[model samples]
Target: MPQRSAVSSATETERKYTAADSGSLPDLAGLPRVAGIDVDTVELSAQYYDTADLRLLQSKITLRRREGGDDAGWHVKLPGGVDTRTELHFPLDGAGASSDEPPAELMNLLLGVRRGMPVSLAALLTTSRHRHRLQGSDGTLLAEVVEDDVVAVRGSDGAEVNWREIEVEIAPSAGSHDMATLFEAIEQRLAAGGISRSFSPSKVHRVLGDLLPAAPELAEGARYLRDYLVHELHTLDLSDIAVRRNEPDAVHSMRKASRRIRSAVQTYAADFGLDEALVDELRWFGRRLSPSRDLEVQWERLAERVSEIPVDPYREATKTRIDEYFSAKSETARIEALAALDSQRYLSLLHSLDTLVDELGKTLPARRRKSELNPEKLAQSVAAVAKNVDKRVARVLKADDPHERDERMHRARKGAKRMRYAIEVIAPLHPKRTTRILARFDDFQDMLGEFQDSVVSREHLLDILSEQGHAAESSFGLGILYRLEGEIGRQQAAHLEPAWKKALRSAEKLWA
Candidate 1:
């Protein structure tokens, strides 16, 4: 059975001196000295351990076991600040015992990495430690000191090695500058002892132990796609936390992450498991969040731009117009968006994403063997995405009424965006052909984006007016903005027709 005990902190004091300076020893100065016995100031050896998932690397955790030292044990060091390491110790004897792994208290610190994986013994290091300490102005507690260790290495094979080194670690209270001062003093003393600073940072190369194998290489494209997805996922998680805490801009950040992930899915569908229908659904959520995000961006942009207007008349008018526009109906739309995100539908989408990620992780590794982006295959994929977008657009055009048209158009914009992202991915492989497709897609998307932004802004302005008890004022401005937005949409639609025709011609020519 293994027993647990808390290691008490002790105050230490010592001074480092070189062999040449040993003849001119300074008096105790009211502190005791601790010295090593018959230990040559040479180099040492050690090896570090981490999980295959790289969780420990991400968290900056260092796990090592050392030999040839009076205090050889399992050392788990968690990152503190710039210069501090929160070191935890476990006796070497219980390392093989099932009950002797790192304490349960450290589980949370490990995150999810060590949950099921067995901790294997990694390396053996031999070290000799010379300990010391520094005192405060009144001889009270200040900082402990350490001078270490020479000659460390790995492997069981008996072979001669050449490396020499020393290290000085100060107590946390000593501060960075104080630590630098102590290091300089120690170096000067070691110089007198006929010992110089080792060229290497660690003594590990001097010891003998079994060498660890290098990590296997992953498929380049797949790895790039996965890294991008992981970053977006982490951003989404952070945004969720910010929203829960009611932080400013949290909703906007969350929406952006959702959009980016949705884009990635469409872009890398060949590499990852992405269903066109499912991606459309995710885009629907992104569309719902867009109104809030757009309003936020426009407000900030307009404010910055309007501030630079040299004429007071132009500046005041622009500011008033912008303020009145945003003040209308803005609260209601923001509230609705937030409520939608909190709804069961949104949560279901999030849960689905989690499941998708897990499934992809399992299948992606196996599919690495078949990973290739042939131009013919890519052209077919692009055409397929374009066809999907056309279908959605047709539905919007077929709607009989304005309200239905608006809803369908919104859906169509999402489809167009998905197709556009698909083209973006293929652009790298078939630049000229993909460029033509993307150009058409862009024109269509920009028009739809404009239409949606107008609708959202009009709604917001009305809400703000209603809140201010100026419904009439709000209505008049909303009407003007609405009409203007309609004109913009009509203009865009007219331009897109020619662009789409050109795109089709180009796609056929290139693929032919």
Candidate 2:
């Protein structure tokens, strides 16, 4: 087995300006800080890698191994907010680093977009960099500005391009407001020197421009669904990276993205001709992610419920027992969830999702032209979902038996969730009409969610009670907690009628 390099990640925010090869450096010794500037020079050689089709580049992701800079190593840069990118770094001399192949772990981060395609050397860039550090009077580093003369060669054709670009990057110490002002000042100064902002996102992008993917053009009618699907796919990709990093709330986010994609696809199935098999696979993927997020939510909720015990000793005891119980459960669930994500099934699902998005983007416009993707037809479909939710709500209210009511309640919650997501997908078309309706459904779904949570909590508490080894005090506290969850469930159930009624009232105006 090949040893993988340890990876570290950080968010980088920077702006780039195209400059003429012979342009003199702009004088920045009198910017906002008006202090001395520190300057250094470095030579760098970098090898970029991506799929044969440039999948990573098309997704605005870049992977490269560079030597000669202070931070020389293999780097993966992920797209972030405006003028920002999240960078993952691996040491050059780390175990698997000798080969041309990227570290397996870092490559894994690209799986969502790579879709199991083999990556190869895409470009080679060599840069001579003049680095300038702008500083505060007390020697604080405010920002680093670099003038890079870069030569890039395309790996496929060995076609070479040379250019000079100036990059301004804010330091961690730079205040947000101050950084904005600083960038403005620097841009003005650069503009005075005849430099303009670069159109290319990166040096490699410019070198491989002809091979990059083109953005799909959507018809007016196809725009809403297409945009929503694209946005969700991007979220899923980002969340996949976050999960691989094991960042906080990563599993929850990935799960929610999966749900959003599944919901949107299911809701708009008729309009887009999405595959049912893909939906089933999405369901399977989401189920795999559920255990970790479920355990986390249950633990937090039960820990909070412990405070309602009203006795100091019992509350603390209950808290400790719940915490300990959930700690073990959460760890196991997290390990399982990550393992599932790392499996081949998850990669296949990603590939299917990628295919779906590509197909939709390419076909929706033509479908709209045929009137097969009518907005009214989409509205009617959502109305059908609303009707189902209403029927389920009615059943929940009329059920007499406790077990039947419990079963009916679960169905109602699921129905409400589907309705809310349906409205969310179509809200762009009827924003004014759907805003209040979505709010009501949000309230309805939240109440149902709490009720369902209590249901699950009570079951777990019962299992705890049936076990043999707990201290009498701990069990006593848990017993009280079990009862409390039952009471809470009843309270939530009672509130359900008014909530659904409010949601129904707002929904009535949706198609009006």
After superposition, the stretches of candidate 2 with alpha carbons farther than 4 Å from their true spots are 1-5, 175-177, 364-368, 508-510
Query: Highest lDDT among the candidates is held by which one?
Result: 2
Question: What C-alpha lDDT does candidate 1 achieve relative to the native structure?
Answer: 0.52
Q: For residues 1-512, what per-residue lDDT tens digits would candidate 2 score against the true structure? A: 63443898888889988999796877887899748799999999999999998988877889999999778999999998998998999998876676588988787778777877889999999999999989999898899889999999988998889999999998878878898899889889899999999998888888997886567777544666767777777778788888877788888888887887787788778777788787788889888889888888898888877877877877787788788778888888877887877789988888887788778668645444777666666777777877888888889889998678878999988777777776777777778888888877788888888888988899888876776777777788898888888888899999988888898778766565
How many pairs of residues in model 1 come into backbone collision? 35
Q: Which stretches of candidate 1 lie over 4 Å from their true place?
A: 1-228, 234-253, 263-288, 297-361, 364-379, 392-408, 426-428, 431-444, 459-480, 502-512
Per-residue lDDT of 243 in model 1: 51
Top TM-score prediction, candidate number: 2
Error of 2 at 451 (Å): 2.0
Quote the positional error of residue 141 for candidate 1 in Å.
31
- 1-512 per-residue lDDT for model 1 (tens digits): 53444321232222332223123222213432222212223233444444543334433455665444444555555444444445665555652422335543333233322323344333344544543445555543334433453443323343434332334455446555666565556556556556554443223322322243233344444444455566666666546544533457977887867776787687567645566565777778877766666777666644554554555555665567677666554565576666665566766666566556655555434334463633445556657766776676667667887668778777767766665654554455556766766776666666677777655544544554455444443345444544565565556544544554555555554345
What number of backbone clashes does candidate 2 have, counting pairs of residues 3 or more apart or in separate chains?
0
